[model samples]
Target chain A: MARTAGSDGERTEAAIREAAVDLIARHGYEAVSMRQLAARVGVQAAALYRYFPTKEDLLFTLMREHMEALLGAWSEARPATTDATTRLATFVANHIAFHIERRSQTHISNMELRSLSPERLTFILRLRTSYEKELRAILRDGAEASVFDLDDIGLTAMAVIQMITGVIVWFRPDERLSVEGVTQTYLSMTMRLVGATTNRETQHVHAGTRLRA
Target chain B: MARTAGSDGERTEAAIREAAVDLIARHGYEAVSMRQLAARVGVQAAALYRYFPTKEDLLFTLMREHMEALLGAWSEARPATTDATTRLATFVANHIAFHIERRSQTHISNMELRSLSPERLTFILRLRTSYEKELRAILRDGAEASVFDLDDIGLTAMAVIQMITGVIVWFRPDERLSVEGVTQTYLSMTMRLVGATTNRETQHVHAGTRLRA
Candidate 1:
């Protein structure tokens, strides 16, 4: 959805979301009350309700938006490529870049699934499954074309996702490595992990060179 | 600590710990109260304090014990062989097994560090550092001996740990894959991630043959 820049309602909603993500990420979803959230946003409790009807509604919105944002980011970043190696490279780079930029939202998305009701949980899980399936498809294509060697596609996909997503846990922008440095190392490790088909084929492919526009 | 079987006090403490783990894992650390925990254990709030002086004390105890247990498990599981590949294989299997069995404890340990006091958090972090350091040592030895090719030891160790620990997230014993099946696949993925050397000397090591005990 396109945002008309600088509207009162949009601004309040954004502020509420920003505060909610911070609070929920710090204290967890179950522990955070709408009153406390309203206080954090410097608004009345009724005003907060006007934006989010219930505590669970606020949480569901946060989680759903996080997943939606991730899906949108990936879609925009996805490159136009047929080579499995390049595709995998772009996937890793995009994932790291996106997650590191939204650390708190990412943390909430991962840690607060228990707070979501069954139906809402199922919806969020579907979003996650679809996102993950994209990576599985890449692995399958690579394995089928002999560009990557994989023992178990499901396990590899999970491992890669966990490994890459783990960057947000310890990464600091001021750390010794730049984002570029970390991405380079992870890309190389990913390629090595999959045992990329041939040195000649992989040596020419630069993961950073072909990221999504 | 050795438990005197059937002692009321010891059983009460154990029950409290178990219930607290479940409650905290389900609702997060900050969301769980000592009163709720006492109720879950069918004990009084006063009795709960007799064992754990404060709420944070209970959290610290849980986090500390989780790390200590992990360290002890790895120590016992550490192999006699000097081969890095064998050592890594053992680490993966033991980690996956230990974590999958105590899913709630693992969840609390990973998710509740935010609730720990600074000093206690440091203590827990120190324990984690030492455990991760063990993995780093293995990677260093393997790199020096040319049994493993790694881009960065720290990053690789972190990646391997997160990837292996993540098994508890989606893994259930009654599912399509058994523990052994999952371990074998993860073992292969871990080996491939490190780019295990296939040299005349290193190629002879077998990860699958030397696991689970």
Candidate 2:
């Protein structure tokens, strides 16, 4: 597979964004200056400004792209099934994988929201809400089908998102558990939290088989 | 009962911490300056320095006290029951209440950790470990007693904490749901996630009584 290399301008812009995520994640968005970022990226300050007109613009671009990437990942990973349990499992797996791989970008996306302009903040939040709405829809459908039990779809969706996104907080690639293991455990927890009937059956078998050992 | 007033110095220190939490929460810790903080608290920079010799010292103190306050709150709210379900309920409720009440402080504590020096970061993380250890112990004991079902104790503890503490992210005093109501829903979710046998019984009763309506 022959791949065309990026042009020099495109490569410089990519380097700028990469360096920005690292510096901002380390020192925070407000503390990181465009000059410092350009210095780290080995580009002139003027070149950096050519890519991002302002500091806030850089932050907004990073945040917007992060959310867009997440939404994009979920769309690709979403299973072609009406079964809520399977759909939710895909959502959790996709979420944990996406976050763990881009820990720095995810951190900036979450923490730098306060620094975004009001209009930009609203734009990013709207993206977040739409992403969350997908999970809420799954919960709603599950509850209606009587295949899952939940007290509130909105709250459950938030809980599931927080609980799974937290994986990046403590997880390390060299750690004892592999990503697959962690995702499986979290998937079970999610299923149980929502009271999926399949989870209950699995739990019974697991308890019967494993508790004695 | 008669109350004693704090000394002027003590009141000034308290005011600085409050203002710092607000400012740091609004803008990242690296972006907030001692001069700006002193201005917010209506104190001279020298007076602020007399209380916290350096900006990092101020940040370290704010974070250290936040964790200490959380640990103290947990100790007070900890139930006297041997039952894991009851203890877990108390933990969830206390955590939600504590974070919700100190939203700004919680935000600063969670976000400003990267700004701490290595030693200070270790101290804060140690306090966090001790706090999380309590939840781990409960999960371990529950697993032994066969009251709660879980794949990983550490993972479950992290999930429950993140899920409950996330209430502060979206909750507001003027929201449609009361804090108590929100806590109840989370408690139920936590109970289900752990696969507490007691929760199953409650769920059956709840479903029988409420799902039909």
Candidate 3:
């Protein structure tokens, strides 16, 4: 397929992607049609196809970008210290903030994997494993250093990921808890979940963070 | 709708529900039509409507029954004692077991809420609230009795539910971890996550369990 050019094309493509996410999030990926998406974006189906030749192509793009954006955000948010507790704290905050802000994208990413091709599925899974590996390394280091008591690194990592991602399900900014409030609550639960042994360790981590700030 | 007579009608209803769950689980609920479902079940569209007046009615039944069955299972599994840790343990074990056994139903119940009508959605949400309240009560009791250390009862309960229900996403029967093995691992994680204060407390809880066994 030939590509569109310049800023106008970029704007249209962005619009299409946004509309696709909202539609697919509301309805499952298999049920959404190109015509419906084009109408949502006020574009012709042909224009939509010009950017994405097939419906799966559009879904694959959305999923891949969601993962890539998450990876980028984590890399930027990850602290330079070797302390696992500090690193894990940052991971929880970043994960919650990112998913909460992109609820539609997160929903589509989590729910629409069934609609992807085998090759694309493998690609997305690899992206997820790499992101998860970052947390696993943090958990491993924490367990080894006795800062965190974890029975199974793999299961703990999965549990942490699912628990945090679940924030998007019921969390609303207009609710009793603000994003910061929710993140704080989750951070405390996560610290306890990993068995951060003492309040002193938590305070130590926070004190260092405050000094840096 | 008029009723179906005999065991043959009973079998067809069973087949329709089974086919509907599998199809809706793969493709979003909106994408699935009564015609497609009937075809998959080797019945006519009219026959499907005979059992389910509207497509939404079918979805509501599946969601309602999933919650009802989960509640019923928990009631059977709920321990008589007030030891929060033991009750919490039972809750985790029962949740994982029920969801893992009904993977398709679980997937549908979790993912298809967007397709339901307003009234049906409220009904399903109430069932969920009631079910979740059971966990919230357990957490509240544990916190009140100082058996479990938790930051927030509601958040902790949500985290535990999301973490355990997530087992169905990647878990397979033929995998290295048997259901019991997964349950034990999760049980350990849950115990730690709630900040179960001392090993002695855990052992005390278990000693009573052992004697009963």
RMSD of 1: 4.0
lDDT of 1 by residue, A124-170 (tens): 99999999999999999999999998888888999899989988888
* Candidate 2 CAPRI-style tier: medium
Q: What is the TM-score of chain A alone in each candidate?
A: 0.91, 0.90, 0.91
| Candidate 1 residue pairs in clash (backbone atoms < 3 Å) | none
Candidate 2 per-residue lDDT over residues A1-213, each given as its tens digit: 012134477888888899999999988888889989878887678878888999988889889899999999989777687988777777877788889999999889888888877999899999999999999999998999998999899999999999998889888866688776777788889999999987445444332222222
Candidate 3 residue pairs in backbone clash: none
Q: How many backbone clashes are present in model 1?
A: 0
Model 3 per-residue lDDT tens digits across residues A23-69: 99998899899999988888778899999999999999999999999
Worst 10 contiguous positions by lDDT, candidate 3 chain B = B204-213
Find the candidate with the highest lDDT and give its number. Answer: 3
Per-model lDDT: 0.84, 0.83, 0.85
lDDT of 3 by residue, B63-124 (tens): 99999999998898888989888888878877887898899899889888888889999999
Best by DockQ: 3
Weakest ten-residue segment in model 1 chain A by summed lDDT:
A203-212
Model-by-model DockQ, in order:
0.78, 0.73, 0.81
Q: How well does candidate 2 match the true structure, expressed as C-alpha RMSD?
A: 6.6
